[model samples]
Target: MRLFPHPFAALVVLVTLGAAAQTPSSPVGSVSPTTGLVLRDDVVRALIHESSGDRIHDGVQRLALLARDNAGGYTEAAVWTKAAAEAAGLKDVRLEPMKQGPQWRATRGELWVAGPQRYRVTSHADLPMSLAIKSGSFEGADLELVDVGTGTQDAEYAGKDLKGKVVLTRGHPSATLRRAVTKLGAVGVVSSYSTPPWNLPHRLDGDFPDQVGWAIVPPGLVPEGQPAPFLFMVSDRQGRELRAQLLTGPVKVDVHVATEEYPGHYGILSGVIPGTRAGEEVVLTAHLDHYKPGADDNASGSATLLELVRTYTTLIRQGVLPPPVRTLRVLWLPEFEGTREWFALHGADPVRRVAHFNFDMLGASLSRAHSRFLVSYTPDWNGSFVNAVSESTVAFMNRFNGVAYPPRKDFRIGSVTGSRDPLDAHLDRYSRGSDHQLFNDHGIPGVAFSTWPDDTYHTSGDRPELVDPTQLHRAAFAGLSSITVAAWAEGPGALDLARLVAVHGARRVAEDEFRARRDLASAPATGVAGMHRLARAVVRAAYQRERDALLSCVQLGAPAKAVRTMTQSLERAEAQALERLDADSKARGVSLKEPAPSEAERRARAFVPRRVKGQELASFDELVTRAAPEDQPRVATVQAALREATTALRERGEGELRFYQLPDALASYADGKRSVADIRDAAYAEYGHVFPVEALMDLFGLLERGGIMTTAR
Candidate 1:
């Protein structure tokens, strides 16, 4: 039994009700004369000035003030905590406070570039050496300081007697020279640079030992009387002559810098919507603070949560939704630590909750501007129910809005989505990177709503004027729909009671299986093998027993819950196997290893399907012709999957690898627009058979990846 209905029938309803489905309306107002919603002129006018609209710059200013006024740049964080509490009007908006140590500490002498003699001497204020001087008896060590050209990877450093004395370097690669200098018995080295360019690539290896003086010296590295170091000035002719000469020369060295430490708190603001039923809870989440204005980066998400609360409250008041059967808790955490503390305090409720809906950076206009798409981040195939909800939300948006969005590319999602793959798949891909991570990590189905900045993300220029409010509305609508649907789906009496019980029971069984296989090391190999054999037999028997039941229910239209339960059961079986292996290995004081694959499994894993080249499947004649068969439900699923995959693949411009779509490969193949054969051929052409089916399945495994394509099977 499938939860999805027939495609032809669904398609008609979709076409006719597309606007209505995508854009929900207030009872007071109707859609425009053409398409989509039309707020009453008064209402539209009011929204223009609404605080919830797009007050990003204001929020950013607020953040800046908070950072500046508070100790350790955390007072701004406290302000956010307060704002979240005040916004919800909940005295106990789950305010949890935890301190984060100094984000950066300077230990070495400060290096500076005035006109650039490339100085390395000590500071006027008792500053440390720019480079730790180590002199091992040079015995008559008549030493002179030397200047290596700019420290670019290709910069030449060959023109000086750089032994037994100090050396000054130009840029980044200076640090790489420390050991070599030590080997050469050079007393010291100084790497210097002027004020940086507008943009700086985040270097992963920025930190170094304090002994080496990885410092920031002052503007007086060049003496007031002396000319600047050779090749320091950047006149056009100078640059050309230097380029021609590849200038390298001796330079006096001076080092100076001051360091300090400050303490601050990373706070998370949380609120709760008490539930009516026992043992059920739902959490709405977002992060409340950041280092920059973070408009689309996050100010949008924070604001989205604010508006969502209003909408949810309104919907509740209007009786559009039932009183929540489960507890509904909203959390505005200070990213990771705040979430961790909440989990510690609240215990395991997150995992046990009905679901979680997260709002983070919901107003990014770039996706829409460039691609007319809304992006979502959910868990990978190895994800859980929480992940499914995230994926489902995106699908709902697409279906309701009748808009095309990127398919769930595991690799792409994995990157901007943020969390490490394999280990963090179940957690918010962007969680550890942002705030949704803790809930997702605890097994609460969670999703991150973010609009990545096109040009301005964390910069000072992330002003409110740059934000697109219409896009915010779209994100809000999408988020609201997901929350509403999840509430209905997970709420008591929302679906057949028996089916829910079956789903829960089946999930437990799967967990039990996982625990078993996960502990294989604790049992004898023969017994473990026997248990696996029996497990498969049990699964076969269970399928046989339930197959007819499921098919009959489908034929009789028993209910949607039945399909959800059956699918859940299969998912559980797989989960159980993995868990069993993990648990067994742990019990035996050993770790479970990735299983050696047979040829078929290896081939399946190795395959990388070719995505549609240029045109969208909706635009392709063959796809339309293939899609014409409206009777088969699988066609819709396959087509939707291909549509998303193709769109995402194309969006990834050259010079960048697929990081978001992790474990990169085609997953399961069904003929929507492209057949399994076509996918296999594509993979053969692209990556060969080293790609595995499991990898592909994992890529497309969870529902969160589906975004708007949730209607697909």
Candidate 2:
């Protein structure tokens, strides 16, 4: 039940197939804790089979063209998405617009190595990704090209005079800007960046020498009184060539970049399939924006979502599937910003929203990209039955889709247009990078289904042809299976779901209980009171989260009588978890009571923070820019701590936190009731890492100062 999320996609099929092979005479049904309804296995599989990789593959091709054309950007994709949704037979398809800062796009851009043997380096007309997004226009002729290796640290440019020069660095454009341009004097920027393992540290990048990364050059990145600079994103080979030239002699560079920023609105293309229950909804989301040929990054996500809309609506229309108990609303929107705006501005009621399933980068050539499909679920703080529901669904695939001839043996569903590669999927630890975070932040539990460590991630090589249809088919099938289950958590099916939740809830409770015991045993030298406090969080969180997951079934319209019965099961789970603590205390020969709050905890309890709308910070560096100069250093320290807490020390052979998840855990835990200390505790309980309370307060204070947060209503 506790499967690992690891780099090796090759897991023996025998483990999960054990149960799935024992097919029920009648296809097994999922019951809900509340409604006691049932959705038959045969019906669910039939609905999922409607997902066509062929259609998804074609969708990606069309979308890639729209993405490649800078003239259209996200709005263009939204327009296409609106039409696609309507054609797919989704009711009430529309493009919802949200106000946003001006959009930036490149018109014309070119870089050249000026000399006797003059040669053009790169151009926007040739490769649009060559120009970093939001880079301002600049024109310079025969300027010095300074080679500052990486340009991240001061030592990179310690004695070099970068004034009126193009600083060619193989670092992130933002880092180069922050250190080289913002602090040091540099006129122009060019980056030859490679993908590094940020979250899934165990994964490795392929030898993508020609891949040019998509980097950002936001406004205010440069110092005051400096010329607004332009950024060129060149391939690793191109950058190495330029760096070598600079080392040989004083290399002169000629550049001309033309770009424009216009007032743009974040567009979200959406449509809903009406359900038996009016207001209650199950939201399926996938981002639509990324650089050209971004097939794997998100065109694949958007395409697969389009297939879902098409498949589901068509099935229901044909009476092959009944109307869902809850409305199924599909969204194809820009990444983080669009999702946030929709949740904040649109009607968002946590009680009414049943679950959210976000698909990002679902398509990947398993062998080529060195990719594995990942199912990253909600943190325990957002405790909902969705985790158990999705987990079981994915676990089901771990068995159902296997290579075999014997009864209950390996089964694979392949498409002619798709690759024959096995569906390499795993249930990864929650690492947020897509639209699912907004749903969790809004208090509705969610999960993200995607692939990672992609060689073409955020690069020019993420082409449509490279996106495997078989992977897309598998992702679509797996995702649809979960979505359909959530959609129909009504009547007898709802009660069956409740049972499923109980099964998974018990697994989690047991895992947490074991962890609590382990924690206590690891610190045996401490006094009874100290020991009680140390294990208290783990034990308490386990019981608390599982209880909530069971109770969440009530949101799906479960009957009171059924819930009462389910509550008894929860009591059992709670009792089992408490037994571990009780046994530990008995062994220690001291009575254990909840430890009193420390000074930090007491301060955190009183200080409740609420997010302020309309003030969004993009990154840690951007957040630092908003803080007062003195507070900026504190923000920097917080950033450093956050980085350390999220990334695992792979050298120790430890597989713990995945870096990207920190922002979601920090952002989502700040509801009205939870104080700074409460959020901190939840984060620690969710992830084993201890994020300092002081560090959290520092970041929270900056959020408030930047108008992204306020202490209270």
Residue 619 displacement in candidate 2 (angstroms):
8.9
Model 1: per-residue Cα lDDT at residue 321: 41
Error of 1 at 194 (Å): 15
| Poorly placed runs, candidate 1 (over 4 Å) | 1-52, 55-61, 64-71, 99-258, 262-264, 314-323, 337-351, 367-374, 380-441, 457-463, 488-493, 496-561, 564-713
- Listed in order, each prediction's TM-score against the native is 0.47, 0.86
The regions of model 2 sitting more than 4 angstroms off are 1-38, 68-71, 178-185, 196-206, 223-227, 348-351, 404-411, 527-531, 585-598, 601-624, 629-637, 647-657, 661-664, 672-678, 693-713
Per-residue lDDT of 408-474 in model 2, one digit per residue for the tens?
A: 3223555668776655577765666677766776667789988876767777888988888878888
> What is the alpha-carbon RMSD of candidate 1 to the true structure?
19.9
Alpha carbon lDDT at 228, candidate 1: 19
Over all chains combined, what TM-score does candidate 2 have?
0.86
lDDT of 2: 0.73
Model 2 is weakest, by summed lDDT over 10 consecutive residues, at: 402-411
